[model samples]
Target: MKSRLNVVFTCFLLLPSMVFAEAQSRPRAVDDFFANREILATVYFTVGSAQLNRAGEQVLDKLVPEIEQLDPDVHLVRIEGVHPRKDHDRMTELAMLRAKTILEYLHHRLTVPVDLTLTGSSPSPEVRRAGRSQHRADIVVYDNLFDPHTADTNEALSR
Candidate 1:
C-alpha cells in the first residue's frame, strides 16, 4: 500500500510539469504556415515582370480582406522567392521586384504591416532540361516568421 501510494504521489507531482513541458514544446500557431493560415496570396511572376496582371491583382484583392481578419496579435509574415534555371538575369530582376511588390501590395491594400522574409536561389546552377520549368519560379506564401530549416530559430529562442 505504501509503494502504491508513493507511485501515485510521484505521478501527481510530475503531471503539472509534464503538461507545462508539452505546452512549451508544442509548435506555435504561426508555424501553421504549412497549413496555409496567414498567407492569403502567393504570386508567381513570369520571366521578367513584377507587374501584377489581371489575375494577380484579382488574387490580391481577395486576399486583402482575409489578411485583415486575422487577430491583431499575429505579427509574423514570410515571403520567399525562387529563381529560374534559365535566363537568370531576367528572373532575378523579376523575383526581386516581385518581393518588393508583394510587400507594397500588402501595406497599401491590406493596411497591415508585416515582417517580411525574402529568399533567392536559382532552380539549378546548371540548366538541365525543359522538364522543370515550373520549378523555375517557385514562391511560397507562409506566416512563419522564422525558417524552421535554419539555425535562426534556435538562436532566437536562446535569446
Candidate 2:
C-alpha cells in the first residue's frame, strides 16, 4: 500500500508539468498583439552606432500595435543590443542604452511596458562570427516568448 501510494503521488506531481509543457510548446496568441500577427522582429543598426535610422524607426513604429496588445501577465518583451567585433564594454553600454531608448519609445509612444535586456559577446572573432553573414552586433535580444515560468523555475533549481 505504501509503495502504491508513492507511485500515485509521483504521477500526480508530474502530470501538471507534462500538460503545461505541451501547452507551452504550441504557438500562442500573437494576432492580438500585432496587426500582422507576427510577435517578433529584429532591427539592425550600423556597426558602431546604436542610433536607429529611418528604416529601424519604421520597423519599431510597425511594432507599436503588438506592444500595445501584449498581456502583462502572460508575456514578456526582451530587448538586446549587439556590437560587431570590437570593444565589448563600450558596445555593451551602447546596446543597453539603445535598448532603453526603445523601451521608452514603446512606453510613451505605444503605451506598452517593454522590458529590455542587454548582452555582450566575450568570445574571439572565431567564436563569434560566421564571416559569410555580414551582419553582426555585439549585443542581442533574448526572447522568452514561451515557458518563461518554467525557465525561471529551472534557473532556480539549478541554483
Candidate 3:
C-alpha cells in the first residue's frame, strides 16, 4: 500500500512537468502548425531598390483577394525577400526592406500578423545566371481553415 501511494504521489508530482513539456514541444505559432498548407505568391522588384513598382503592385492587387478568401481567421503570412546581389549583409537588409514594404501593403487586408524572412540571393549557379528573377519577394500564406478539427484529431491520436 505504501509503495502504491508513493508511486501515485510521484506521478502527481511529475504530471504538471510532463504536460508542460508536451506543450513546449508543440507548434507554438499558426504558421508552424499549418506550414505544409500554404499559397505562394511572388512580387518582383527592381535591382538595388525596395520600392514596389507597377508590376509588384499589380501582383499584390491580385494576391490580396486570394489571401482574403483562404481563411477568415488570423493566419500567418510569411514574406521572404530575395536579392540577386552577392553581398549577404546588404542583400539581407534589402530583402527585409522589401518584405516590410509588402507587409505594409497587405496589412490592411490581412488581420493576422505577417512573418518576414530575408533570404539572400540564390547560391545556385543556374539561378545566379537567370538574372532579375532572383530580385523578388515570395509571400507564403498559411491558411488555418481546418486547423481546429485537425488539432482535435491530432490531440486524440496523441493521447
Candidate 4:
C-alpha cells in the first residue's frame, strides 16, 4: 500500500511537466497567425509603346475596387514588368514607367499606404514567346497580420 501511494505521488508531481512538455512541442499560435495572401493583376501594353491599351484600362478598372476591398493586414504590393526583348536599359525604363503608372492609379483608389516593390524586366524566353503576354506588368499584394514582438508579449502574458 505504501509503494502504491508513492507511485501515485510521483505521477502527480510529473503530470504538470508532461503537460508543459507537450505544449512546448506543439506549434505556437503566432506561427499560424500571419498568412501570405496575394492578388495578381496583369496589364498588357503595346510592343514598343508605354501607352495603356483599352484592355489594360479595363483590367485596372476591375482591379482597383478589388484592391480597395482588401483587408488592413495587407502590407505590401509588388509590381513586376516583363518585356519581350533583352535590352536591359530600355526594359528597365519601360518597367519603371509601367510600375509608376499603376502605382498612381492604385494610390488614388486605396486609402492605406502600401509598401511597393518594382522589379524590372524578366529575361525569360517563355515570357517573350507568349506574344502579347510579354509586354505586361504584374501586381501582387501580400498580407502580414501579426507583429512578432506583440505576439511574444501576448504569449508570455497568457502563460
Q: In terms of TM-score, how similar is model 3 to the real structure?
A: 0.56
Model 4 lDDT tens row, 29-85 = 433331353547988887766777788878887877666665544355667666666
Instruction: State the lDDT of candidate 1 residue by residue for 1-159, as single tens digits.
Output: 978954654454344335445664655542343456344456666655666667766776777766666543344454444455424555554555566676676678767654454443444333445444432222344443444543366754753
What is the full ranking by lDDT, best candidate first? 3, 4, 1, 2
Q: Which candidate achieves the best lDDT against the true structure? A: 3
Candidate 3 lDDT = 0.62
Off by over 4 Å in 4: 1-39, 111-115, 123-132, 143-159
TM for every model, in the order presented, reads: 0.49, 0.50, 0.56, 0.57
User: Lowest-lDDT window of 10 residues in candidate 2?
Assistant: 133-142
Candidate 4: clashing pairs of residues: none
How does candidate 1 fare on TM-score? 0.49
Query: How far is 64's C-alpha from truth in model 3 (Å)?
Result: 1.2
Best by TM-score: 4
Report the candidate with higher lDDT, 1 versus 2.
Answer: 1
N/CA/C clash count, model 2 = 10
List residue ranges in candidate 2 displaced over 4 A.
1-39, 112-128, 131-159
Worst 10 residues of 1 by lDDT: 131-140
What lDDT is reached at residue 41 by model 3? 81
lDDT of 3 by residue, 28-83 (tens): 45334544546478888888899999888888888876666554344545676766
lDDT of 1: 0.51
